[model samples]
Target: MGQKINPLGFRLGTTQSHHSFWFAKPKDFPAELQEDERIRDSIKNYVQKNLMKVSSDFEGIIRIEIHKYKELNTTQVKIDFGRQNLLTREEEEEKDDKEEKKKLELLKTKAKIIIQLIPEPYEEPHILAEYIALQLKNRIPLGKAMQKVIELMEETDIKGIRIQIAGCIGGKERAHVQWIREGRLPLQTIRAKIKYCSYKVQTPHGVLGIKIWMFVDFVDEEFVDFVDEEFVDEEFVDEE
Candidate 1:
């Protein structure tokens, strides 16, 4: 079984060594910086600069990545935060587990200040993630919760979003899977370009595994046309 969910608001409580995120979409970036790669670099630089300014003691590496979606009009920015200089395993082991955990939590909280550097439009995903975390705090039915998430994303520029939750749901003994999606289904393919995020939300019943898949957009119309043509050809062959 998965570890129990961290306490509420414990976004950084997991054993993850790094926290990374991709801005949902580009909004209002300068014309020259509109490209996904450029936007990713700009956001990474902006975040690093802002964090450095606030925390002179902070010294970490930030990596920026831009994933091309489909033919290139759609792009996703991925940013990774490295835990360099945070602490060594030896040093961490020297402290009590609880004390070390608290220290790490504080460090993460300080690191999270970088969230404020994100601008509007692009910040929608972050807000949506927070919303999901908050809404799952209570014992709402899994289907209902996923439906609510779909409703929330329908209003955004997200071309496609999928949410999957697994675990002892509704206080049942047998673990189950529940999921929902809005817009295009996130297909696994070279052209689909899906970015993912995972979180563990603790509930009255047990820890619910939350997985989010964000897609650049629907599959190309050309692909859809090809699929239809193949279907028609197969139907014709069957009629023979």
Candidate 2:
């Protein structure tokens, strides 16, 4: 006769063993004693004895559920890339506009001093013109030059002072020294022929003339520096 299978649910196999068995109880199994440990032990002992009755379908379900749980836990989230480039362009335009405004204000605050060359006997015209241009090129502004002259003129008590250029000989070379002076002219169209004099110094390149003029007012000295510093450009510098 075949051995009878235990129908009560049971688990078999040692904790380290790979193969195990699960069995369901028969309908005639005792109801009141179902949860008793003695009853459970009897079921486990019988299932191990009749191991061929354990189901393969239960093991397959458990394996599929474990893989599904792992897939849900490992997924990643997404971001947008063009926002940095727009911010950089805005900063560059603001810097360029500030530099242009500063240059414009500097040009508005200066006056012009016109120095005409009068040809004199015994001097080459170009020599005198070149000499005068060199002397003024790097000399400290006329304000300082005027102060020194004022002190010299006072010592001599020279009134109605006139500057005599020993060799003022230039055919058409005209030099203008401009600056910002304090007083306004009585009329905008007034023109006067103010006579001035200077000494000529010869250099390796050419002759240089230093023209001297008497200032009726010290304010004219300041006006000239302001104008030259602002309106004069590279072409004027090149003319020298």
Candidate 3:
């Protein structure tokens, strides 16, 4: 009277009802998009990143297909759980269909995706970007700007920093890029917490891209604290 369970713990012959599905079927979504082969890779990548909680699920590979139609240029997405044996219909399951429908009704309310559009309200980059923007508005020379920014960042707990600016600087026609840094380079170093931000500076010369990196290891003993050298006194008399 009991059903068999698959190796993955999924109950065999249990029909996965549309009502109990993961993704919500939007009204404008085209049902035929499920069958389209062209956009399969795109849909798979998007779903793998945004949906499917388990990384192990990627090994089995969730199949997703998308189709675009010219009638108002709408897009439809289809998802396949990619479990092959479960695809076949079993006659015994048909007898339990009514019972399954009743169970689905109980579970349908729980099936939903809660997406957090703004996960972090106060990110560090916002503050850093604003500081740099305020500094660049002075129309100072590239080297002077870099030095001033480094001086400003020294007051903070940042371990290391780098700033790079490119394009025709100081009203010159030729384009060039130069970078300045204090302490270790954040990107190249291994096992260091690093924060990165970039901003564009529009000036009379040309547009300049400003990249900032703030290394976050404040209490790191290697950089800030050190051991003093041992001093010894030797007896000297003959020479005197």
Strongest candidate by TM-score: 1
lDDT of each: 0.46, 0.27, 0.42
Candidate 1 residues 1-240, lDDT tens each? 766442112222221112222233345343324443444444445434554565432323233433322322233233334433333465333322433243234322111111112222221333344446556675455667667777766766677887777888778899999877777843534345444556666777788788776665533432222122221223323332
Model 1 gets an lDDT of 0.46
Tell me each candidate's TM-score: 0.42, 0.18, 0.38
User: Which stretches in model 2 have alpha-carbon errors above 4 Å?
Assistant: 1-138, 162-174, 177-197, 201-208, 213-240
Off by over 4 Å in 1: 1-116, 120-129, 218-240
Task: Please identify model 3 stretches exceeding 4 Å from their true place.
Answer: 1-129, 218-240
- Residue-wise C-alpha lDDT for candidate 2, range 103-140, written one tens digit per residue: 22322212111111222210221222223344334443
Query: Which RMSD values do the candidates have, in order?
Result: 20.0, 51.5, 27.4
Compose the digit string of candidate 3's lDDT tens values, residues 1-240: 565222112211221112111232576345433323324444345434533343323212232322232332233233334323222244223413432343234323111111112222112333344445445566655577567667767776666777666777667788887888887743433334555556666666567776666666522333321111111011111112
Clashing pairs in 3: none
